[model samples]
Structures are given as structure tokens and as C-alpha cells.
Target chain A: MEMSALWKLSYGMYAIGTLDGERPTGCIVNTVIQITSDNPVIAISMNKNNYTYDCIKRTGRFSVSILSEKTTQNVIAKLGFSSGRDTDKFDGDIFAWEYMDGLPVVNENSCAHITAEVITMTEMETHYVILARVQDAKVTSDYNPMTYKYYHEVIKGKAPKNAPTYQAPEKITDKETWACQICGYIYEGDLTKEPEDFVCPICKQPKSMFKKQ
Target chain B: MEMSALWKLSYGMYAIGTLDGERPTGCIVNTVIQITSDNPVIAISMNKNNYTYDCIKRTGRFSVSILSEKTTQNVIAKLGFSSGRDTDKFDGDIFAWEYMDGLPVVNENSCAHITAEVITMTEMETHYVILARVQDAKVTSDYNPMTYKYYHEVIKGKAPKNAPTYQAPEKITDKETWACQICGYIYEGDLTKEPEDFVCPICKQPKSMFKKQ
Candidate 1:
């Protein structure tokens, strides 16, 4: 019964775009599969606690932006690390987007994009599996896509509690390690010696989110 | 925009266990989601064309055996490349399994085993997503799980047409390339002069399934 073998499975990162009334918003999701070919249909699993779920329920539409290896770490940091409820996720002009199906899709250098309309949503106790029909799709790049393993190994990212694959971070052996309370990014070295305003590189959270351990 | 960055999503490969009447049989699936926590529920997407789907439809129950990184390629060759319609997939004692919720579960080697009953099913054009509640669950191993990416890279396995992510193999540039007509595993070098015992590595189809192109 080896659990390590499960790591062999492949996955691609994506940003899901949806709207609440006229406000455009989106979140990160790892599970997106095409269920049909003719009139192509796709599905995405979103945690019930996510704010994007409520927005998709209201708008009945969403878009998928396929993240490439070239995508900066800030994409996941901006969309995944914080809740859209607190701040406007797209406010900083950090991402360039376009309006489609009445929603904002991150056009900031992605590999491919797809806009879909929610056809059905099945409620599970903790998550919502939203099946949708692809309305439009386009290719953005030819670079190789970044896999989840590469993200963990290269980007050194951690899954949040709201993520479908949420697992607690492994305890670090570093004598002085700090973890971001928001996104769970672990800082190996000391930060107190630096400026009091030092922020997390992944989520941009203030040093206050860091806890000495 | 680099398309290579599209790969950072996470996914795990799994052997979906089910009973064909009283006999044990199964197939491979990449999508498995935990829909609920309390009275836990799980959802899996199966292609309508796969033999495993019909078996689950008849039994109304199935077990999800989360494959670990240690899972051998032979297991996939047995359960995935070969069809249960002709051969007894569970025969030869290849996997150690037990009946749970009236369905067989692979207990020999997996991260975790979960048995569930099909509570609801939504039919898509090419596939069916069955939403089920986890009737029983148990940890089988602590090993890291096998992801789809690892399967492609390490095992050199390709997705079948029934898979949601199946993409047509890229055309070969070299002449005298022999391709498997059944599952599309291609032999780039000259294969015509090979022994008469040549068989498709993927589907185990006879050499007759090969086409000269």
C-alpha cells in the first residue's frame, strides 16, 4: 500500500473565470476535464466554500485559462492564495483580461483559453462538480504546460485548505522556518532580521501572516 | 505566451474496481473527487465506451483503488490496455482484492481504497459522470500516489480513445513507421522485419492491427 505512486498522475493548472452580476472574478482549479467531444463539454470541481462557486451559481458561466510553465507564480498567488471576497483580485493591473460571456478571463499570457456555460452542477457535501458546455476556445501558446509535480518541486507551492487536494504541509527541519497563514508558503530562512514590512513572496501577505516556529 | 506552463495541475491515476455480476473487473480513470467530508462522498467520470462503465451500471457500485507510484506498468497493461469483454481482467491473480459494499476493491497495493454506491449519474455525450457516496473507506498505504504525468513519462503509456484527455498521436515523420490500429502505440523504426510475434504494447492486439504508413 504505497501512497507515493499516486504522485505519478498528471495535471495542469488553470484559472477559472466567472462573474457575479457585472463584476468579473475567477479562481484557480486543478481539476478540469473534457467530458464530451461534439459540442465539447467540460467539467471542473470547486470546493463549496470557495467564493467563486457562489459567483458561478449566479452567472451560470465560467472560463478556463490554461496556465503554462512560463506563467509567473503570482498567477496562483493572486487567484488561489486570497479570497476574492476581501479584495478585488484583479485590481492591481497585475493581469490583463478580456470580457467574454459577460465575465473577465485572464488574458495575461496563458497557453489556451475556454469559455463555457454551466449546464449542470451537482452538489456534493464539500464540493461542487460543475459540468459546462464549451462556448468558445482559443490557443494562446505552444510552450509545454507546467505539471503539478513541477509546481511542487520547482515553484515550491502548497495547496490551500480549500483546494480539492488539500494536504497539510510537511514539517520542515529548518531551525527557523516561517509559514504564511494565508497560502501556507514556507519561508526557510529568518525574516525578522529584515524589514518589518517583509511580505510573503507567493501571496504578498504582510509579515504578520508569517508565524515563527 | 508559453503553452508549456499549462501543465501545473494535479491529478492521480486510479484503478476503478467493480463487479460484473459476481466476477471482479476494473479499468483506469484519472478523475476522482471527494464531494463531501461528513458521510464522505466521491465522484468519478467514466467513458460510456469503456467496458467498466457498463459493469458499474449493472452492479450500481464500485471501488476506487488509488494507485501508488509503485504500481507496476503491468497492472495498467492488464486492467487498462486489455479489455474485460474478452479476457477475465481479474484472473491470473494479478491483484489482491476484497469485496466491499458488494464490489471488489484492490487491497494489495494502493494509497487508499474507497467503496461507493452510484447515487446519481449525469450522461454527457461521450462519458458519464457518476456521483456516489463513499459507503466505506480505509487507508491502504502511505506511499505517494501515481499521477497521469508520471504514467506518460515513466511508463510511456498513452491515453486510450475512451479517456477524456485522449489526443491523437502526433504523425511520425520517418517512413516505415508501424502504428497499432487498436490503441495507437507507434513504432517509429522499421517494424515490418520484426518477428511474427510482434503485438501492440498497448492493447495487446495482434500484429495484424498494425498498419504500414
Candidate 2:
């Protein structure tokens, strides 16, 4: 079948937040939907192997921070590409966040925030669909929230194995194209000789971010 | 905090197929997600009040036909605005579909067809998150999949009260603009007097299909 057709499905990027014991932790997810209106229930699909899933299982609570276009690449690199098991994913200047109901929430230029209590979980082979009831919700910004399409076509972020929208890496086609060292954005033309001020279109990193293969 | 940020989230329009007793029926939904890769699992959020939800509970099976940009607005009006319990939603030429694994599958110029078996269900405050394992899958066409954005901006389709994405109808700002009588698309200038051959930018319906309000 045409797998590319499935890729055309639109989605939004989000940072899922939860607590691991006394420490706050979370991961990135693209699947979060409002399941109900009256009491405001939501559903989120998460990989069973994710550290945030384990945390949610223990705490029975989590938060969804709707990321905006202004969110920096370092935030995704720390909370998404890196595993919380190996590093303190929320530590340092990479992200600025605060605690809500004892759970850490990343404030990395997000447009909205929602905290929910897990109501049920259904296991589906490689992933878990978690249904939760909204406990606290707050609007944070007027910025436009980032779409999953924009994350790929504009931000130039790669979907890791855990992402529901993950696609197998594409083979390189041309020799003149240069790839961003940080976000893997392919530049179709020679960027090396451009002014030193040139920045990566997807991640907005400076010219130093580009590396030739 | 800006609640308007929710406007940035992207979604798709679909006709969720199910069986009602010996008859086939379905409804509109905006929330569907691929939960896994290997065995291919999907999750859909449906309001408890929808007739299709009851049908799915009894049948334990359903089909998802991912609508394309080419689908007619009448398909949504026939299925979305009317209740199958009282109306023969599929009667006349309202919609063209066939039974698949005993459930109706819409053939309205969709991008793909997915038939799944219900594995688990979680009850939320006002809706249900139905997780199903895909049993059959097929690609139907190469047309661009219709996004919720395209539905609103192009076809002028509005989310029903039972839809997870339902928002208060936006106020119309201009009167000179000609709106598609069926899907609500507003053209920059009046096209009603144009030859009956004029077509809508969204659902692709001919001017003959529109009725000026």
C-alpha cells in the first residue's frame, strides 16, 4: 500500500509531562485528543517503552504542553531524542518549567497546558492508549501551536522510533545537498560558501550547524 | 493563557463505518490515531451519544475510510447532521458504500480503507476511546487526504456537536462573499450566477449543487 498517503495525515507536536518519584520527567508525543467536552477528557497514545509511560503508570497523572513554533530544538533533543532513563531530561537551561500538583511541566514556549489524571490504559501491541480526565488546564500564549507536518517540513526534526508518526529514514539522493548537524535539514544547494550568518531553515541554528557528508 | 492556541492543532475528516443490526451505518469523527506499527493498531474517539458508537459496541468491528479532498459535502451532511436511528442515512443516493467484514465502508473517493477488530475500550466522561487492532488494510487512491483545516477553510464543513473537534461556529464577517450552499465555502466573489458548471474549491461540487441562502 501507499505508506506515503498515511504520512499526509495532519498532527500536532506536544510535550507530555509526568513525575518520576520526587523528580519531574516526561517525553514527546504527537497523539493527544480531546475525547469529551463536558468534563474535558483526553486520550494520548504513548509507546510502552517510553520512560514517561512508566512514570504515568506510577503517578496516574500527566500533563500535555502544547508546543509552539517558537519552541527551540534543544527542548526536543532533550525531552524527545534522549531517553529520560539515561539522563535527567528536565535538568539545566535547555527547558524552563514549573511544578503543578507536584508534577513537572516544561514551559518551553508552549501555547497551552493541560494536566490530567489517568482514567484507564489499553495496551495495543507496541503502544498504550491512555485515557485521562482533565484536572487543570491553562492557556499560556497566543503563539500558533506547531503541527507535526511543520515539525518535519519546517523544523526539520526526525521522528524517533517511539513516535506514532515515525517514518523509516529516506536514502540520500544528491551530492550537492548539505545536512544540518543538529536537526538533519537537507539544504539543496551549497550552503558552505554562503555568508557566515546563514541559519538552518528548520532549526534556526547558525551556519556552523551545517555539515557536509 | 490563550485557548485560541487549540486552533493550531490539525485533524482530518472521516466517515467511521459500523453495523447497526443487519444494516450498515456510520458517522463523522476527527480523532483517529495509529497506535502501533508491527501489528498495526488504531484508536478512535467517539461521543457516547453517536449512533455509530452503539453499533460498534455490538458489532466489535468497524472500518475507517480516510476521506480525500474530492469527497462531496453531501456525504457529511447525510451522515453527520442526521441520526441513523431515525433516518436511513444511506438511503437514496446520499452515500455510496459497501459492507466489509459485515460493516459498511465508505467508497466516497477516500485515500485508504482500514478494517479493524475492537480490542479494548475505555469510557470517558462524554466520549469513548476505542482501541482496535487492524485486521485488513488497503490503499484506494492517490488524492490528497482532506485535513480538518481544509474542511473548515475550503469545504466550509462544521464539526457537529458530537464531534471531538466541535467548536462554536465562527461569525461570518463578509456578506458579499458567496458561500457554498452545501459545505459552507465562501468564495471571494459571487459565483452563483456563473454557469451551473462552476465548482466549489473544497468539496468540488458544481454550482448546480449549491442553493443560495
Candidate 3:
């Protein structure tokens, strides 16, 4: 199969927030689709290994924070590249969030938030397709929701390894590309030209964390 | 719940092509998502009432035509608004298509095509989540794939009743708007000023079929 063709299938950037015991924990996902109109059941693909997946499976409740274009990459760095098991994704001042239905949701810059209760968890080889029914939802802003295309092309973000749409970084032979070791974000030009304080846009890692490719 | 918040969940415009016995038939869908990256598996939600759903269930194989921005609204009208049970959607000269892995797929103006074999069909309250493994796929063009936002905001096209994301046409009170009776496409202006041959850009219906709001 020509796997690259699958990249044409579009998606949106989202954070799946649920509680691990009393701790607010979550991770980034790109595959969220409404499965029905009335009562609005949405389906999201989560890798089985995701800590957030275990939380949602146990709690039976979760919140979908629909990330917008204006949403800073810091949100992705906190909730995506790192594991919720070790890091308190919502504890610091990286982004503002609020509890909806007892689940933490990104409040600032996100376009909307939907609280849902899990209805079914269908197992696949490497992922679980969690189907949930909408419990409550609200529009947070008028910002355009960030699409996977915009995230990759405009923000120069890289998908987490657990993402269903994640593809390996292509080999670069034509440019002086530097890849962020923390998040795999590629800096296309000479990395030294930037300020000493310049960090990886996607992961917020220091310049020292980037290695020449 | 503020149901309008669900609009922030993003999606792509696609044509799900499958066979009705020996004839070719399909419909438009916005909820196609990959569930795995290695030996990619995709999941698509199909409303139980759709004719194409039964066809895919019976045949156990289908093709996805990743529609691009250049793909005309005619493709949506032919494959979306009409039913394959009564109408031969692919018989006319409306669009170009070809068979891949014994299933028909849109050829021109589409970015890619993927043929898949059904892995499982999990029943839901109003729809069935059909999971399939990719059998073959090919990138057809370099054109940007169309997102659901672009389809509604730019093309002014309405979703079919069977779609998971289908929303009722909101009442427009502020302006002189005319809605196509066939496809529910809203044209925001006096319909009388257009040329005699000005068909509804969505379903190609005559101007007489439009009703002022």
C-alpha cells in the first residue's frame, strides 16, 4: 500500500482530557469525528499505550478541547510530547484551563470544548476507537479550529508517535535541517542564526536539544 | 448542550465508493479517520439508513476518493444528495472515475484514492462504525484536499440528511437569501439578477427551484 496517500485524509488537532484518579491528565489526538447528529456521539482514535486512554477507559468520561489556530504550541508541548503519567500537564501556567463535567479542558485559545461520557471502546491492533456521547458542550471562541494540515504546514508541528496519522520524519538531503530531539520538529535553515534563547516551537525545548541532521 | 460547538470538530470531504452487487455506487462522507499507522486501518461512520452502507456491508470492500478543492459540487450532488437504489450516480457524464481493486473511485480532481477491506462493522445507536484495513492506495494529485469547513463556507453546500454532521438549515432573517429546494444551498442575494442559465452551483437545479427565505 502507498501509505503516504493516507495523509490526504484530513483531521483536526485536539486534546483529550480526562482524570487519572484526581489528577487532570490528557494527551493530544487528531482523529475526532462526530458519529451521529442527534445526541451526538463522537469517535476518537487513541493509541492503546496512551496514558490518557487508560484514564478515559477507567473514568468513562472525557473532554475534547478543540484547539484553534491561535492556540500556542505550548499546549501541544505539555499535553502531547510528554506523558501525563509523569508530568502534570494542567498544573503549570503554560495554558489556562477549566473543569467541565469534572474534566480539565483548555480554556484559552481553543475554539470549543465538549464533555462526553464513553459509550463503547472498540479495540483495534494498536488503537482503541472510543465512542462517546456528548454530555455538554460550549463554544469558547471564534478562532478557526486548527486543522492537521495547518498544524503541519503553517505551524511546522510534528505528530506524536502514538498518533494514528503519525509518519516518520522524511530524510532531508537538500537543506541544513535541525531536528528537535524532544518532539521531532525540523528547523529547515541554519539553527545558529536564531537568538540563544530560541526554543523548539513545538516542544519548547532549548536550542541545545536540537541536533543537526 | 450547545450543539453548535460540535462544528469545531474538523473533517475532510470524501466520496466512499463501493459496489451494489455488480454496479458501482457510493456517497459522500466527512468522517473518515485512520486508526493505525502501521498497516493502516481506517474507520468511517455510515448512517444506518444510507443505501451505500448496505452495499459496503454486503461487498466487504470499498474505495475512498479523497476529494480536493477543485472537485466540483456536481460530485457531491451526484454521490451525496441522490440514492443509488433509484439513481445510477456514476452512469452519467458528470465526473470521471475508474475501478481500483474492483471498486470504483473518483479519478479527476481528487487528491488520492484508497481501497480497503472491511475488518469490522460495529453497530451504534444511529450509525455503524466501519473499520477497514488499507489494501491499496495511490496519491492522484498534488491539489489540496477539501475540508468540511471549505465545503460549507466557500461552496455553500449543505450536507445530506444521512450525514453524521448534517445540521438543519438555520433560519436566515437578516438578508435577501434564497435556498435551493433540491440541495439546501443558500444563495445570499436577489436570485433574479443572475443569467437565465444560472443553475444552482451546488445541485445544478434551475433558479425557479429556489425559495426566498
**Model 3 pairs whose backbones collide:** none
**Residues B173-203, candidate 2, lDDT per residue (tens digit)?**
3344555666555454466567777776445
- Which runs in model 3 stand beyond 4 Å of their true positions? A157-207, A210-213, B157-181, B184-207, B210-213
True contacts kept of each: 0.34, 0.45, 0.83
Q: A1-213, model 2: which lDDT tens digit per residue? A: 434445545578899988888888889898888777666777889998998899899999998888887775556766887677766777766569998667777786888888889988877777888888788778787665777765775456454544543332232334576767775555656777899888764456898877774
Candidate 2: which pairs clash? Answer: A139-B1, A140-B1
* lDDT tens per residue, model 3, A1-213: 778899999999999899999999999999999998998999999999999998998899999999987776557767888887777888757679989989999986899999999998988889999989999999999988989887886555444544443333333437788878887666778999999999876567899999996
Residue A96 lDDT in candidate 3: 91
TM-score for each candidate, following the candidate numbering: 0.70, 0.73, 0.80
DockQ, per-model, please? 0.26, 0.29, 0.39
DockQ of 1: 0.26
- How displaced is residue A141 in candidate 1, in Å? 3.4
Model 3 C-alpha lDDT per residue in residues B68-100, reported as the tens digit of each score: 877766677778987888878788676799999
lDDT of each: 0.71, 0.73, 0.85
lDDT of 1 by residue, A1-213 (tens): 223332333456789988766677788887787666677777788998899999999888888887766665556777888787775776765557777656677776677777889999988777888999888777777644656655675555444444433332233443577767787666667778869888776577899988875
Least lDDT summed over 10 consecutive residues: which range in candidate 2 chain B? Answer: B165-174
